[model samples]
Structure formats: structure tokens, C-alpha cells
Target: MRLIYCCGVVLLLTLFSRVSHGGNILVFPVEGSHWVNMDVLLRALHSKGHNITIVRNSKSWYVEENSTYYHSITVPVERSLGKEVITHLISTVIDFERGALPVTSFFNMAVGMMGTFTEAHRIVSEFASAMFDDQEFLRKLKDSNFDLVLTDPCWGHGIILAKYLNLPLVYNVRWLIAGEAHFSLAPSPLSYIPITGTGNTDKMTFLQRVKNVVMYLIGQTQHHVVVTQTYQKLCEKYLGPNSDFNELSLSADLWLMRVDFVFEYPRPTMPNFVYIGGFQCTPAKALPQQLEDFVQSSGEHGVILMSMGSFVSALPADMTNEIAAAFAKLPQKVIWRHKGDRPANLGNNTLLVDWMPQNDLLGHPKMKLFVAHGGTNGVQEALYHGIPVVGIPLFIDQYDNLMRLKERGGAQILQINSVDKDNFLKAVEEVLNDPLYRMNMQRLSRLHRDQPMKPLDNALFWMEFVMRHKGAAHLRTESYRMPWYSYYSVDVGLFLFGVFLLVLTTVFILMRCLYRTMCKPKVKQE
Candidate 1:
């Protein structure tokens, strides 16, 4: 559909459109088990007068959208079953090669190669799934049409869907996508690149830096190539009259970062991108009685909330024991989220549970510090609670994000390999004793909470903007049309400059030879 945007008519049209769309908004969140955050956004948006229909293959279902949120095992909306399978296969191969499942070394090589190859495959899979769910989602719209399409950026599928359906699109980035150098496109510099900070502050050892760079290249190269292909293909298959792949990406209209500026300070920003931190946050509910009691029982020294996010589960039991031993030394109570039977020799001031209300735990006034695996969402929650962290980074962006936080003086960065008694206890002690750390966290928390509008509100605003303007043609960059060499300034300009330099050097050499020959007299000719 070719949507034309005529000035002055937009406001009137938007008014009419708003009146027409009294039903629920259809949201296509990323595929996986941790879509609880997305469900929160959907429910919250629905409460603001729009109904919500969720189309995902996740296990959990929203209480309100039971009718609209389809739960088919093979619904097909996820980016690509084939690509996902390929990623898994690569991960497995990496695991096998490293002789470890969670190895973050050369495994990046496999991730990059596999991530790119599967892009097209994943896009196809998600499109198929959307086709199946479209009928149901559109049915709800008859009485009240879908107001906008808000999607997780990880699923490039959403951008394509918005273009195809002529609906408003709001791109939600779950991580940091700033920094002059691509930051390996991991969102945050600390997460994307190695050798962060300088001099004494550099956390990575020499070997680690080499490993980090290699891993970053492998994963990012694959991501850059694959995402570009997937995005372009999506545009070609969908976008509008004069629209192509280049136009869609460059002119995204509105970009939403699911991160707070507080965490990524002194950032270089663009007008189209807005910080929508705490999108994953839920309203404060009373904690479970038992959990509350556990916090109360901690008393004077307070407690340490330890979790390894959803993806990287608890370390091996032996590693867990090492961590437990470290916790034993601290006067503070420890609440560890380990999905196993309680440790046999559990310490007096410690508790172990499969899961706890993570946000609730972080929110507790008595919560002293968090020991986490440094996932972006978890880091945001910790920052929100004004709590310092001991980030025991594992894989993906965890390490880099923790490093960034550490640089900002908000947390202590720890390595997974060095998670024993000494390092762990030292980290805990430093964060607990440092008044500056807590002060810094509070400063960031104030900035985070003081956004002009709620993150969801901002997201909705952008969604409507896309609808209001149809698609922002003025915002698209024309550079994507140029060849890669040209785009990188390796085109005619650089090529011609190089040729001139070569000619000058050759003439100079010839002139020197001529002068030397003439000076040598006629002896050679005679």
C-alpha cells in the first residue's frame, strides 16, 4: 500500500483513525520464553484504551488476551525456524569444539557464520507464522482496528510487517546501539567491543582482549551481513511504491531504545532514537509473604540478590559451591536463584530458591547489592533500585555491559572464570563499603525515572507517528544505494587519488635515474 502524507490532512486523518481504532493493538514480540516483559508492555498499552492481541509461540499467556494471544507450537511468526536451528547447531558445534557448553572463546566464529546464513530462513519462518496469525489479529480489528505495530527489533520481521500492512511501526531496541564505531552492533560498547577503558582501568587481560576481538568479529560480521540481507529482502518484498530495502532501514521513522541514558552516559544520539528505559518494568505488587519474611529475616547486614538471568543458568554445582563459600564469609544474607535442591551445607545467612520476584527483591530497601550475570534487563533493574552490582559476566553482551557499568563507577566487574572465594568476596566488599558507588547508582536512577514520559508512552507515540506520516521518506539516507566501496569512501575519489600518487612517484624515480645517468658522463657510451 502506498501511503501519502499531505500536511494538515494528517492531523484530521489521525483523529479519524483514532476514533476508528477502538479495538486491541496486535503486537508481535520476539520468540522465546522471556516474553513476560513484552506481555507487560502489551497489558499496559491495552489499559491505556487500546486492546492487545499477542501472536507468539511462547509458553506464557496474558490473562486479558487469552482470546487474541495464540499459543500454537507451529504458528510460524518467529524470524526463522531454520536460522534458529542453524544457530543452535552452531552453538552446539562450538560447545562440542570447546568441550564446554557455555564457552565464550572461539565460539563466536561459529555464531557469526551461522547467524548470517540463517537470516533469510528465519525471515521466511516468521512471515509464515504471521500469515497464520494475521487472520485472527485482523478479526479483532474489525470492531476496533490495530492502532499500531510495536515490535522487538531483534525480530526484523516487525519492520517488514509494518511496511506491508501500512501500519505504524515503532522499533524497540533491547540493547545499546550507539558509539561512533559500530560497537560491533551489540548495542552497548562494553558488550560489543573488547579492550574497553584504558590504563589501570582496563579489565581485560592481554589474552582476553585477543579473544574478545576475535569473538566480536565473528558474531558481528555474521550479524551485520545477515541482518542487512534480511532487512533488504523484507523491504523489497513489502515496503511501498518507490520504497526499497535501503529506504526502510535508513528511514526507520522512530527508534526506541529499551535502555536508559543513565546507564549509557555522554552518548551521541539522533533525534529519531529515544530512550525508553524500564519498558520491562512491572507495577510494584506486594511481595509473597514467604519471600517478604525471608528479607525480614536478613536483618541488619541486608542481603545480596544473585541471579544469572534467564539464558545462562547457574554455574556447575562445584562453581556454585565456590560462590556459596564466598557468600558464607559476608555478613550479609544471600538469596541465590539456583534451580536445584538447597545446598547441603547451606550457611546461616543464606537462602536458595529456584526463582524469586527479581524486581521485588531489587526494590527492597534492605537489598544491599546484586551479584548478577549482567544481562541488560537485569542491569537496568539493578540501576532502577539504586543498588550496586557485582557483575559476573559470562557470554554475549554481559561482559561488555558489566565493564561499562564498572567504568561508570556503578558496579564492580567480575569474570566468570575468577568466581572463587577471594575475588567474589573482594568484589562484594568493595561495592558494599563504597558510598560513592551507591551515590552514583542513585544519580543514574533519578535520571532513569525522570523521563519526559513513560517508556511505553514514548513507544506508542512513535507508533502513531509512523501511522501519521505513513512512512518517513524524508528520513531515509540515500547512501545505501551506493556500492559498498563507494559507501566506505573507497570509490572513484579514493581510487583516483591513489592513481595520482602512483604516477607522481613513478615520474620522480625516472627523473632521478635520468639525472644520475647524465652526471655519469659519456664514458658508458664511448
Candidate 2:
């Protein structure tokens, strides 16, 4: 017994020593603190004994319960290479259309850069801008002995930074990104190809499935061209002025995604992708005192949480009024996250604040249903709390995510354009009253939480894995080399050929039997 105890202590000490010296990880958030995933991921890393530093804005405050050694510096928004000139030009065009550059423009640009001159231009421009930060985040990245660089897809700069530093990059995606070649990165089956094992797109409705196919087809050429061009430009900046775009595209290495499986269930996957979502150690602080008091007043009625997210609040005044009116009539109390202080004729049943503690509110026992714009973070929070939701998706992935939640039976969905008091009230009522909705949400919550290891630990482990392997080159190279047709082999020619062969065989067999019967002497007598 003494010998066994001594051996166990020795083993633990060895393991602890290895972990204490784990590789350094540098994280770059695509967006500011408003992004919930950023906070969650950082918290997860800190908990798992990983050394980390953030290259982000000073104003971007993310809560961490236990502080770890980190460097925080604001990257100046202004930089030259005059990339902003082109960015602003594109922004102007989009602003004209929707009063903003719009996230779709970024998606479009990402797809277009796959194979275009603009792709090269954007790559150089982004690199220049990223490295030009006044705080010298790039310089620190170079000086620091970082094992891996983790970043959001929106922060393409991280790719260049990793390349320049000869480090491995782990990409994080907050939402489902549809692949032109195969299935969408989202949890929904809408991206599946029927015959090809790439995905099972059959899980969606006929109309939605058709829509997915069409979208994929239309975006294919654009994505390829854009990515190819951007890679070329990136290569020229790093490799040489004479480097070919095609070769650069081939050399580009980006880890697909590093999210947790719980948030994206039932989605098909390949080995290169990693999901370490819900990395935030735990939910943030509870709701404020004033907010708590308002909810408690509702008693058995409970409260409904509503938010349109941080980036876009394009809900027209008329629509806002309609929503207010609907909430005014509900038996439940309403706590809305609206940036503006605009007063409405809503009854005492409503509470509007510039911002609300979303996760904390979801954790509340009195909280009943969540009304959201269906962003990934919000969806994760709602799922974590096992609260049924009514998703009024406005733009981008919101529509698709809302549909996913509805399909999962944990929420009701409503289109933004068609929303009114009646529809809004009805949707809220359905989520609140329907026991199945709560049960379904609870089921999803269990699945989300039932992972073998916490998302944070997995994220840190993988970050270190990539570091130990000295850049996950094998995964990236393999993922890139896979051709679209080969990846999703829904070959019409093969199907046709198989059918033809089957028909010919059947005909030949039947003729042999018929000829024998007709030639027989007994058949003639009959």
C-alpha cells in the first residue's frame, strides 16, 4: 500500500509538471467583447492551465473570474496600405443598399477572394492593417514563444500572422458557414448532398433543401475565385512578388473550425475541424438588482427575454412598436435588450435596458422563453439554460439557426418582415405554454452539457496538440486537396450507368426464357 501510494504521487507530479509547462496560445477575436464566444473561449483556456494572451481592443472587456498572465493592448483602427480606400468603397456601395457594409458583404468578399485580383489586394491590405496596429500586437506575436494562434474566421489577419510567424492557426467560427463544395458548417442538415456521403441534406423541407442547393450552386464560382485571388496576394506578400495565385492557394493553411460538438449536434464532420464551443468556464454574474426585482413581480407568469444582438438593430420603429404592444398584453414580464432609451407605451409588464445580462437571465428560474435574433452565442445561451425560444431572425445565419432550433423542437420561429403583435404574441405564447418545447430544450441542454470533456479543456488540448505537432499541416493540406466532385460524389453518370446495366441484364434474361418457351415443340401443340 505504501509503495502504491508513492507511485501514484510520482505519476501525478510528472503529469502536473508537463501540464504546467503547456505551450502558449494567442487568441484573436474576430469581433469585440459583444461576442459571447470570445469570453467563453478565453475562460475555458485559463481554467485548463494554458498560457494565453489576447490581441484585442482595450475597450473590449471580457470577464474572467480568475486572472491569468495576459497582455491586453488596443489595436488602432486606422492604418495605411490604403486598404481602407477599397474597403470604404465597398462599404459605401453596401451602405447605399442597406445603410451599412453588412456582414453578407464580408461573406461575399470572402467567397469572391477565393479567386480574384481583389482577393490578392484584400490579403495585402489586411496584412498591412493588422501588422500596423499602434500597440504592435504583431511584434509581440513574433517575439512571444506561442505554440498556436487561435482566431475567428472574421479575423483573417490571424492567418497571415500565423503564416508570417511560421505558427499553426486554429480558426473559430461562431456560426454555420456553408461550404461551396459540400455541407454547411452549421448543425442543420440543410447542407447535405443526397447521394454523396458528404452530408444528408434530406433532413430539411423540400423547399429549404432546394434553396440550399441553389445557394451552393450560385456561390461556388464566386467563392473559388475569391479564395484563390486572396491566397495569391497573401503569397506575394509573404513568399515573393512572383508567386502564382494557384500555388499560394494550395499553400494556404487554415483549420476549419474549433467549436464544441454540443452546440452543433447531428452535423456531419471531417477530421480537420474542431468544435470547442461553450469554452466560457461558467455563466457570467447574475442579473442586476433592479432587473431581478422587476422579474420577481411577475410571480408565476415568469419573464420573457428579448434581444436583437449587438451588431444590427435594424428593427423599424413600427416593428418595435408592434413588439412592445404584444409584450404589453402578455401575462409574462418582458426584459428587452435595446440600445436606445426610446420610451414606448408598453405597460409595466415590460423592461427595456441598453443591455441585459443574457446568460444570467437565462439561468433564472423565473425566465421562461427567449426571443432573439438567433445568433450562435444567443442560441448557445438559450440551450445552456434549457429555455425555449422564439427566434425572429433578421439577417445572415439567423434565419437558418432559427429554423434549426424550431426543427429541434426547442423553439418557435418567425420571420422578421412578417412580424407583428399577433404573430409575436402567438410565438411567445407557444414557447411558454408548450411543455414539449421546454422538454426539448432540456434534452438539447443535456446533450450540450454531456460532453466527455468540457469544451475549454478540449480547446486547450487541441491548441497544444497543434503546437506539439508543429503546425497541423497534414490536416490542412489534406482538406484543401479534396476536390469538390470527389468530396461530394453525387455522380449522375454513375447512377445512370448502373440503371442502364440493370435494365439490360433484366431484358436479356427475359428474352432467353421467352425464346426457350416459343421454340419448344410442346408449346406449339398447346
Candidate 3:
């Protein structure tokens, strides 16, 4: 009887202990596909007994107002980046890509895209302003006594909010408002590490390197004038004149990067940046019976899965017809996630659904090739499942993501503008027929899986680590605090150059004097 009573007490103690250790985590997430991955992390944290509270805009496109895992705090905002805006931007970019004049197309596309980016940041800045203007909300946030702030730095709202709340900040980050998080945190040499949208691999020719440098300058200018302009004004008004949005954005205690060395080119990184690529992936669950039957029907030919990701619901009608026609030429069964008009040329073997279980389908034994738009999540998931890709990249970082896989001999990239039945068929057939593509991807999968700890677990540890230590100040570098001249040691180099010139001038003067003295006649010296 005493033994049983003691066991019961121990069980109760364990349960209480878990509840006691729960940390109050405040999250500020970005919308669309970014939120998809952020939700995965939030669920994981909730399962570990952490209490999560999310701050979202009332006009959120994806985030729900209610959830069992986390409490939602919705800020009322009049405007947001809606679906229509994104769809129109995509359509315009696609049209530019297919334009007859290449130079005009590229120039217009660059300007229009940058303008869209600037406007989006401006809208995000307004969202942050709305949050700040609410006195009751600010009081509630302060009273909550949150342990840390987890945010996606693509927008600057979270960074500014974290500063206002005086909480330790951590990032569920890939792109910053400036650009890729690595460029902001690490030593990214333009000679090697390819800038996003440049489409150059780590290995580059002379002209490519020149192009890389030009793009780097253009990107930096865009970040300053286009991206940070609105955020900077908000920072000055709320956080005081000394506050810099760019600096605060880089001041996070930890960066849980959504990529790993497996998918990224080898480059320098900092201690605080943790790679948790494919952390959202898990073993496949049982597909619905109907879907299972479809997979089984494929038999020896296997199945090909295609998805354009969360934002791109469908392609242009003509492009869709061309893709469908290409699929008709293949022996394999096809499952494409599309919400566009039904293509007239769609093959009987192809199944078009508004949505499908992308991750689960990729894990299926009969899965053969992935036709993807080169989003980070899809690409990482593909790598995780050891599936080779037939990449049809459309916009912004999609081409770059495909380029990385292509560099590794694991995928084939087709230009969206030029995609037609013949070229699309050839690309798909090459990836499907080629054994090397599968082998290389499998090798990468093994490498990704062989890690000492799971990426998700590592991310959790770092998040909790920040909570325990109050912040990871020791792990974070002070480089962000330094000016550009100080960061690159340009001041030091200039000082050294000045000192060198001074010494050289002194030596020259002394040599002239000494020669004059030595060569002078004895009578003159006397």
C-alpha cells in the first residue's frame, strides 16, 4: 500500500514539474509559407509544455484567430499584403520574363519587384505602428512577462516589438528585410558565396563575379532606400533617434536559420546561427485511401508530384496546358496541386487537386520525381525524402534554390518563360531516367539524417537556452554594433597606410640629408 502511494506521488510530481517548467514564449510570425513553417515550430514548442502567444494582424491571410496550442493576439490593421496583390505581382513578373526584349524585361522586372518590396515593407511598418499605438495592448504585453520573442525577421515588426518590450529575441529566419540572414550575420565574400537572385553558383567566372558584385551593391542599396526607409522612421519615432532598424534586426540573440549546409553552399557562419533545415519534416503518415489507391495504381512507373507552393496557386493557362501535355508524354502517374483552370491537354494519368499532402506524397515508396517551384521548404523536404527534382522556378529566390540543387547534380532547372511541352518533357525525362540525380540526392539525405541531433530538437534547445540565460549575449557577435568602416577594418587599414607614408617620407628626407652631408666637401662641413 505504501509503495503504491509513493508511485502515485512521483507521477503527480512529474506532471507538475513539466507544467512548472513551461516558458511563456511570445511569437511574431510572417504570413504565407513562412507562417506554415513557423506554425510547425510553435506546435513543437507547445508539445514541450511551453506557453505560446502569437501576435498577428487582424487581416492575417493564413494564421487563425483560435488555436489550442497558442493564444492569439490580433492587432487591428486596415491594410495588409493580400492574396490579390501577390497574385498580380506574380502575373506581372511572369509576363516580364516572357517579354520579347530581354533587357527591357529585366530592367522593368527589377524596378517593379523592388517597388513591390518597398510597398510591402511600408505596409508592415504600418502594422507595427498599429500595435504600438494600442496602450491597452502594450500594457497587456508588458504584464504577460514573456521570457523571449520568437520572430521571422523578413519583416521588421518583431524586432522593433522585441526592443520595445525589452525581451530577448530569437529568429525563425531565412530572409531578413535586407536579404538572406547570412549576409547580415556572417562573412559573405562576393567572390564565392552567391547572392540571392544572382543565379551564380559558388564557382563563378570573371564576368559572373563582376555581375555578383554589381548585384550585391544593388541589393544593399535596395535594402537601405527601399526596405528600411519606413522601418527607420518608425524606429526613430518610437524607440528614439539613436535606434536603427537594421541594427536591431541583426541584434537577435539567436538565429534559427531555415537552411543547412546540405542545401546551402559552404560558407562562414556565426555561433548564434543554427541550421534547422527540414525540421518540419517527419516520416510519412498514411495517405487517404483514395490517394493510396492512386499511388498503388502507378505500379512500376512510380508517381511524380508537382506543387508551386503556398503562394502560387496556379500557373498561366497556356503554361498549364504545356505542362499537362508534357506530363501526358510520360509513363508515370502525376499528382499536381493546382487551383487554376483545368488544362485542355491534361493527361488521363495526371490528377489535379486544389491541394494535396505534399510532404506525405513525397515520402511515398512509389514517389519518383518532384516538380517544384524551388521554395526553401519544398526543396529541403525533397532533400529529406531523397527525391530528385524537376525544378520549374518562377520568382524570387526560387531560381536560386534550384540552382543550388542543380550544382549538386541532384535536380534539373527549367526556365519558366521558355517552358513548353518539348523542353518540359525533356527536363522531366532526364531527371526521371538519370540514376545519378537520385543517387546524389540520396547521398545528401543520408548526410542530413546522420546529424547527432534532429534539427527541430536543436532549434528547441537553442530557444530554451536563450530563455534560461535570459539572452545569448556570449554567443552573439558585436560586429553588428560596429560601423562599416570599423567592421571591415577600413579605418585601421587607412591608419596603417598613413603611418606607412609618414615613415617612408621620413626615410626619404633622412636619406637626402645624409647624402648631402656625406657628399659635401670638408671645407663646407667646417
Candidate 4:
């Protein structure tokens, strides 16, 4: 009886210890796909006994007001990115890609995208303003005694909030308000690292490098103009005139990057940046009975899964008919996630659903190929499952995401404007018949799976590490604190150049004096 009592005491103590170690985390997340990944992280944290509080917009498109995992503090806002707005933007992009002239297309797309992004940032800034204006809400947040702020820096509200609360900051990030997170935190040489939308690989020729530089300048200009117009004023109003939005965005104590090197180019990263790519991926779960029945019906042919992601519900009707016709010719059974008018050419071999378990579907042994829009989440999931891809990238970073896989020989790219029954069929047939594509993707899967620790566990460890240490200041660099000239060593270069010129001038003067002295006539001295 005494031994039994002792075991019970130890068990109770262990449980209490785990419960006591739980940290209070405050999260500010972006909507759509970003929230999908962030929700996965929050669930993991919750499982490990952390208390999570999310700040959400009342008009959130994906984030729910109620969840078992975390409590939410919804901030009412007049404007948010709704499904209609995103759908319209995507449709406009497709039009630009298909109809506009080559040079005109590039310029038009840039201007249109910049305008859209600028407005989105403005709305987010207003949302932050709503939260700041609420004294009672601010008091509640202060009283919550949160250990850290976990946010997606794609929007700047969270960064400013962390500063306003004087809390340590952490990022679940890939893109910032301007561009790729690496450009802000790492050494991204244009000679190798391709900028988004350039469709160039790390190995670039002279012309590609020129395009890379031009794209870089354009990205920087967008960042400057948009940030100065929106986040800058918000920072000046709340964090004081001295605070800079760009610096605050880079001030996170830790960066939980959403990509791993397996899907990324070999580029320099920082100590605080942690790659948690495919962290959302897991072994396949059992499919629904209807879906399983459909898969089993395929016999030896296998399955092809197609999804265009959350933003694009449908394509143009003609394009849809072409894709449907291509699928009809394939021996494989097709499952497409589409929310549009049924294509007239859709075959009996294809099943169109409003939604499907994408991760689970990809992980299935029967999954032979993936037709995707190349969103980061979808691409990583495809890589995780070792399924080769037929990439029809829509807009923004989709092409760039697929280019990474194509460069590695795991995927094939098809232009949106040029996809038809013939080319679509050809691309699908090529990926399906070629054994090399599958082999390469499987190889990537092995590499991604061979990490020292599971990516999710690594992310959790770092998050808890910050909680225990109060911040990851040791891992973080002070480089963001430096001015641009100093950060790039441009000031040091100029100083060295000045010194070199000064030394050269002094030597010249000394040489002249020596010649004058040596060549003087002896009679002059006498």
C-alpha cells in the first residue's frame, strides 16, 4: 500500500510539472493559408500545455472566433480581405497573364499587384489601430501576462503590438510586408538567389541576373512606398516618432521560417531563423468511405489529385473544359477540388468535390501525381508525400515555389495562358510515364524526413526555449539595429577608399620633394 501511494504521488507530481511549465502565448495571425499553418502550430503548442490567445479580425475569412485549442480576442474592423476580393484579384491576374503583351503584362501585373498589396496593408494597419484605441482591451492584454508575441510578419500589426506591449517577439513567417523573409534577414546575393516572379534559378546567366536586380529594386521600392504610407504613420502615432516599421518588422527574437532547404535554394540564413517546412505534414490518415471507394475503383491505374488552393475557386470556363478534357484521357482516376460550373468535357473518370483532405490524399500510396497551383503549403505537402507535381502556377509566389521543384526535377511547369487539351495532356503524360520524376521526389522526401528532429518538435522546442529564456536574444543578431550603409559595409568601403587616396597623394608629394633635393646643383648649397 505504501509503494502504491508513492507511485500515485510521483504521477501527480509529473502531471503538475507539465501543467506548471505551460506558457501564455499571444498570437496575431494573417488570414487564409498563413492561418492554416499557424493553426497547426497553435494546436501543437496547445497539446504541449501552453495557453494561446489569438487576436483576430471580426471579419476573418479563415480564422474562427471559437476553437477548443485557443481563446480568441476578436477586433472589429470595417474592412478585411474577403473571398470575393481575392477571387477578383486572382481573375485579374489570370487575365493579365493570358491576354496582355509580354512587356506590357509585366508592368501591368506589377502595378496591379502593388495597388492590391498597398490596400491590404492599409486595412491591417487600421485593424491594429482599432486594437490600440481600446483602452480596456489593452488593459486586458497587459494583465494577461503573456510571455511572448507569436505572429506572421506578412502583416505589420503584430510587430507593432509586441513593441507596444514590450514583449519578446517571435515570427511564424515566410514573407514580410515587402517580400521574402530572407531578403530582410539573410545575405541574398542577386547573382545566385532568384527574386520572386523572375522564374530564374540559382544558376543564372547575365540577362537573368539583370532581371533579378531589376526585380529586387522594384520590390524594395514597393516596400518603401507602401510601408511609409501605412505602417510608418501607425508606428509614429503609437510607438512614437522614433520607431521605424522596417526595423520593428525585423526585430523578432526568433523566425520560424516556413521552408526547408530541401525545397529552397542554398542561401545564407540567420541564427534566429528556423526552418519548419512540411511541419504540417504527417502520415496519411484513412480516407472517407466514399473517397476510399473511388480510390479502390482505380484498380492499377492509381490517383491524381488536383487543387488550386483556397483563393482561386475556379478558372475560366474554357480553361476548365480543356483541363477536364485532358483528365478524361488519363487512365488514372482523378479527384479535383473545384467550386465552379461543371465543365462540359469532364469525364466519368474524374470526381469534382468542393473540398478534399489534401494532405491525407497526397500521402496515400495510390497518389501518383499532383496538379497544384503551387501555394507554399500545397508544394511542401506534395514534397512530403513524394508525389510528383504538374504545376499550373496562378499568381504571386506560386511560380517561384514550383520553380524550386522543377529545378530539382520533381515537377513540370505549364503556363496558365498556354495550357490546353494538348499541352496539359502532354505534361501530365510526361510526369506520369517518366520514372525519374517519381524517383527524384522520393529522394527529396528522404532528405526532408532525415532531419535530426521532426520539424514540428524543433519549432516547439524553440518556442518553449524563448519562453524559458524570456527571449532568444543570444541567437538573434544586432545587424538589424545597424544603418543600411553600415549593414552593407558601404560606409567602411568608402572610408577605406578615402584613406587609400590620402596615402597615394602623400607618397606622390614626398617623391617630388626627394627629386627636388637630390637634383639641386652643388653651387646652390655652397
Best by lDDT: 4
**lDDT ranking, best first:** 4, 3, 2, 1
Give me the displacement of residue 282 in model 2, in angstroms: 3.0
lDDT comparing candidate 3 with the true structure: 0.91
lDDT of 2 by residue, 1-526 (tens): 9999999999999879867776688776644323466666666566556777766542333423234555554554333223244344433433433432434443443344343434434644454455544346656667888877776654345555556676667766542112421243222244443312112234656765765665565454444555455654555666567754433233333443434455444456655566655555355466678988998998999999898776543355667788888888889999888755354657678887877778888889988999987876788788877889898764445655666567678878775546888988888887788799999989988887888887666766766677678776676534344544554564766787899999999999999999898789777788
- Model 3 residue 235 lDDT score: 90
TM-score of candidate 1 to 2 decimals: 0.71
TM-score of 3: 0.97
Query: Judged by lDDT against the true structure, how good is candidate 1?
Result: 0.62
Off by over 4 Å in 1: 1-24, 32-34, 58-147, 175-220, 224-251, 265-267, 282-285, 473-483, 495-526
Task: Compose the digit string of candidate 4's lDDT tens values, residues 247-305.
Answer: 88887999999999999999999999999999999999999999999998998999999
RMSD per prediction, one decimal? Answer: 8.4, 8.7, 1.8, 1.8
Candidate with better TM-score, 1 vs 4: 4
Error of 4 at 327 (Å): 0.9
lDDT of 4: 0.93
| Candidate 4 backbone overlaps, count | 0
